[model samples]
Target chain A: MNPLLSARKVSFGYGAGDVLRDVSIDLHPGEVTILLGPNGSGKSTLIRILSGVLPSRAGEVLLCGRPPRGYPRREMARLLSVVGQDPPVDFPMTVESFVALGRFPHQGFFGETTPEDRERVRQALAETDLYGLRDRTLSTISAGERQRATVARAIAQGARVMLLDEPTAFLDIRHRVAFYEIVTRMKEACGIAALVASHDLSLCAEYGERIILLAEGTVASQGTPVEVLTPGNVQAAYGLAVSCDRNPATGAIRVTPLRGMPAKNR
Target chain B: MTPRARSEDGRLRPGPVFVLLGFALAASMALSASTGPVAIPPREFLDALLHGGAGTPARVLLSLRLPRAFLGLLVGGALATSGVAFQALLRNPLADPYILGVSGGAAVGALTVALFLSAGASPLLPLCAFFGAALSALAVFLLARRKSGVSPERLILMGVVVGAFLNAVIMLMVTLSPPGRIPGALYWLMGDLGLGTPRRVAVLLPYVAAGVVLLFLLSRGLDLLLLGEQAAFQTGLSVERVKTATYLTASLLAGSVVAVSGLIGFVGLIVPHGARALVGSGHRRLLPAAFLLGGAFLVLSDVIARTASPSGELPVGAVTALAGAPFFLYLLRRNGGKS
Candidate 1:
């Protein structure tokens, strides 16, 4: 089967320099693709391109076999959703209303929330464990809860593919684990495709079906965690000396960085 | 829960709030029409309004107070709605109708017409003011645009810079003008609604109505924008189109009011925030509530402007600023000076 989302030789730049160079990747249905990169490695840029937030300078991005931009924005939103790095906190709106915003693409021009939309919003809130706090203002929620609220919004969007940029950055460990479990469940049960850009190698190693290690705007390696998280690839991408091992019981890849040599006196 | 939460959960629907405000506005308009220095009695006021009684009371009611009150209502509603649109479009709580320098541009336009065209009738000033406001609004929009798009921060900055420049131009025109024209120009700058004739209000009515309707249609989009631009975009909002449409509609609203009432400063700045504090942040409820509350607030202020002094009426703008500046500071401090 064809990938649900694909980027073909995509390139992007911000006036002065290229941020992503000839990068290509595919997100398959019922699979989790973890994009691993150090700071300034063009992970965010690639996600933005795929989500159609930023048009690629060169090359094409296809969502379900057609150009992402070919679809009307509302139609595009029905098929694809993105959870950004930071959730907006300035507005004083209830979590329920915030989550209901996900139903935008589905609603008519005036965009009134119907009973079905509310039901979806309620289900999304429950899935993210945020039902009890639905009435609370977003400003009053904790960072973890806020992240979940955004996740709930994406869930409520009912998109087939989700693109999350550092979604777990603000989440605590418990919530982070829950979030990954939810993602895993969605992939298995609903055949949802996800492309998550994250820094948490260990978490990605355990949950990610395929890992794409990016460095300097290029895909340095692509394969299973065991293949991509090799010490040599990690060093090449992140410029750090690391040891890679597999957990005996879980059979998950483990990465450990070695200490650097002491500086020599001048 | 908190008192705010209790209130939100309580029996304060947007429908009743609008009705209540509507009643309050009608009552205030009646009171304002009667309570000026001439002081037409309640019985006389009613008789004059209903039966068209012949006398000085009827003449004052028909000629001056009624027109002024109507102007106050339209201008107030226009400013407040404009404020709501600006605040939502820019996603800045501090954004007011005048934040984009449209008022300053209108002031410059009005001052120029007052100084240069001494032969122009009272009706010509608002037309000139509207032109000036539209020109400045377009300039700000152009200057704020970039390859990435118009960010709220850049828009606000451009507005401030353009406003300052317009103010300087207004001052230059004031200094260069004939000495006799200075007071009229100053009163206009200070926001006088005394010039609002029934004809002028009629002329400006359609633009304000159109702007309000356009903004009402876009209220849902504005609500989504509170989630930030990228989130708004990801949710299928054409952020650029929404931004452009909102800015222009808001400018038209503000400019229409400025053209008629000079620059009634505070109604636009405070009414929406006050309305939000009462109703929640949802624009569908907040915009209409702000409109009614704003109309009432300005009519009451105009009442004070006319009644405060025995010798000459205080400028309506002065009354608003007296209340608005303090409220503005309190809002800033309440937001911990961030807005």
Candidate 2:
């Protein structure tokens, strides 16, 4: 099958610098794509461009078979759910109400939530393991729970594609794994496509079928975990020396770096 | 959340509140009709309302108190709802009814009408207020537009400048106005409710109703917009379109209130803040609650304004300012760390 969404010769930038240049990538159905980069290397920027939050300055984005602009706002929303990395939303809304927001694009602006909408919200909360905390206020929750809550909101949107920015920033290793498994279940159960930006290479090694690395506003390298997360390529992009190895039991790539190794050894 | 708990919102709790508010507002309006200048007893007030009482009491119930209280209700609801929408649109806790310079523009417009018009119930002051408010809104919108979009900062910034200019224009118009006419103009600045007759309320009703319904309809979009512009845009809301709709709707609502009652400050600011504390910020609940509480608040304030001191009456706006400024300080202290 053709890729579900793709960026064609997409180049994006802010004032004085290019964030991503001539980057062409396809996000296929049933495949998880990870965008990896150093802090300022523009993975988030590319994610925004593909999600249609930030327009591409130089190229085109296609969702399904049409241009990004072709889909109506509500229809586009039905196709993709984006969870941004924002400090907790300032409102102290209850967790369920916050999650209910995901149902906005799906339930038309005027209609009440149908039974299907209710089921989707239930399914999302169960997937994120947030069912018990549904009645609690957002401020009372832990950071990991809040992050998961936001992810659950996206799932409640019932979108086929999910764009996540640093989804695990607030999670501990155990919760992070728990979170990814839920995402894996979401993919398997719902066929939702996921494009996540992450600093953790192991996440891609564990969950991603493909990876794209960005450096200095350009796609430096992209391939499967074995090819893209290699020490040479990642080190070049991150400007640091790192070790990459596949876990024999899990088969996920684990990356650890000597913090300040010499350039020659890098 | 065992399914029972998960269904809290879809259950009776949230829905019942609306029903209760509607009953309470209707009762309050009837109560207001009984008190006014003539102090008509309830029986006569109802008789006057239904069959027309004997002379001044009849005129008082029909011509004065009923119209005044109804205007107060409509204006109060409009301002409160506008305040909620504008605050969410700005994503700032401190925003209120006058944030977009509607009050300042109305002041100038009212002053202009005071200075020039003969003022024999000629629709001049309301017309002037509407234009001034509309002009200020357009100016603020234009000034706030940015390359990315119209950011809240730009809107607030433009409002401050244009609001200052409008204030200056108001003072100039007041100075040029005849000294005898100044009291009436000053009454408006202090927010008088004595003047909004049935005619005034009738004139403003359509705008108020349309603006409020627009906000209620856009409540979902407004909820999404609260998640910051980029988040809102990515979620399929046209950020620009929603922002424009919200700003214009808010401006129209505030302007309509200003046109009739001058700048009644506190009900707009305090009512929403109070409702937010109780209902949380989900516009679905908060917006309607704010409107109801705001309506109740102003009617009560008008009662206080009319009855207190007994040396005639204090301006309703002054009463609100006295109350609101303190609440504003509290909000400032609460949000100080955030700013």
Candidate 3:
């Protein structure tokens, strides 16, 4: 199947140094792609580049065969949505109202909310387990709940592709699992192409259909979990000793760091 | 629980609130029209308004008081709507119409006409003031903007810097002027509705109406703006375009008002907050609510300015500042705890 989103040798930098260099990836519909990187490995920057929030310094990124910048903002948003790490904290708005804003692209500039828009917002709130907290102000909610609200907003956008930057960073384990489940369900139901930037190695291993491990502005490894989550690749990328084993319950690759550093780092 | 929860969605039914505010504005205008040194009774004021009687009370009510009240309404409503737009554009609740250098630029333009041209009460003054305001607003926006984008903090900082410099220039002009060349310039600087002729009111109506309507149309964009720039852009808003339109429209409203009625402070700053408190922060509702509330507030303040003392009239700005400063402090204290 053709990829819904593709990046070819995308490079970006701020000031002098490059944050990402020669990075390429593809995300096909009905698949979850986990982007793995340490701090400053340009995961967030790459996501921004792909979303057209920031232009790449070099190389190409295409969403549905056109450069992201080529599409009008609303048209681009109708196809792809992004969930950032932080929810808007400055304004006083309820969760329901906030989530409904994701329907902006679908609605006319002066359009009132249609029943379909309402239904989508309701379903997004329900899926994210935010129905109970929909009336609560975003500022009044807990960080994890706010993060879920952010995800709910993106889900309400009804986009074919979703790029989430550490969306579950503040979520608890249960919510984290639920988040993955929601993405998986969406993948199956709507065939969305999701690229989630995360540090949840084992969790993403179980959920992500493809994994791309990035190290120092370059792709260290890319493939299925077994091919990319090996001991040598993890140590080489992260500079830490880690043992990769299989989860007994699900038969997925599990990565656990050893007590000390790797011999090369030492 | 479900019913109560649904009601808590922050969407206050806007219809009743609008009716209440409209009534309040009408009542305030009547109160302003009735209260003066002459003190026309409400019955006679109503009679004069309907029949257009050619008596002293009718003459005062029609020619002087009603025009002044209508001018106050336009000025206050324009200032408040401008404030709401500025607040949304900057993504900061503290932003006011004059928070950019618009007010200072208007003052400088008025001063230049007053000092150099010796043009007293000429219509050319307002036009010059508007040009000055637009120029300064554009300067602030351009200075704050970088290749990446304009950050709200940087925009506000540039506004402050430009405003202070313009203020200094104003002071220099006032100080160096031959004392007799600019009469009532100080009072004008302090803000007054005394110049609210029927012609002035007619002139300002289209500006306020256009600005308010434009802002209403951009209400959805403003709602998304509170989400911050990147988030708004990601949500399908053309963020920069919206910001540009909002800034220009807001500047036009403020500059025109300042030209007609000199530097009225605090109405722009405080009225939006009151409106937000009444209706939620949805711009479509917030803009009208703020406009009505501001009209009522300023008309009442004008009444107080007219009648508060046994002496001559005080500038309307003095009355607003007297009320607004303490309320602004209270808001600051309350919001300080939240951040």
**Could you say which candidate leads in TM-score?**
3
Q: Please report how far candidate 3 places residue B170 from its true position, in Å.
A: 2.1
Name model 1 segments beyond 4 Å from true.
A258-266, B1-12, B110-128, B138-161, B174-183, B333-339
Compared with the true structure, all predictions reach lDDT values of: 0.83, 0.78, 0.87
Which pairs clash in model 1? none
How well is each residue in A156-213 modelled by candidate 1, as lDDT tens digits?
A: 9999999998889988899898999989988998899999999888889999999999
- Pick the DockQ winner: 3
Report the Cα interface RMSD of each model, rounded to 1 decimal: 2.2, 2.4, 1.7
Off-target runs (Cα >4 Å) in candidate 2 are: A259-266, B1-12, B113-128, B138-161, B179-183
- DockQ of structure 1: 0.55
Candidate 2 lDDT, tens digit per residue, A1-266? 78778889998778867778899998877778888887888878877887777778888899997776677787888888888856344555777777877887777775377888878888888878888887777767888899989888888887888888988889889878887787688778777678888887877788888898988878889999988888899778887788888788887788878776865532
Q: Scoring each candidate complex against the real one, what DockQ results?
A: 0.55, 0.53, 0.66
Angstrom error of the Cα, residue A69, model 1: value is 2.2
lDDT of 2 at A138: 78
Q: Please, what are the lDDT tens digits per residue for candidate 2 over residues B1-339?
A: 244622334323655667777777777777777765667776677778788766788888888888888888888898899888778787766667575677788667766665676553445655676677767777776788878777555676687788778777777777776677756777877788888687888877887888899999888888887777777776678788888888878877887678778878857678887776656667878788888878877877787888886678888887888889898778767766554
| lDDT value, residue A263 of candidate 1 | 26
Residue A27 lDDT in candidate 1: 92
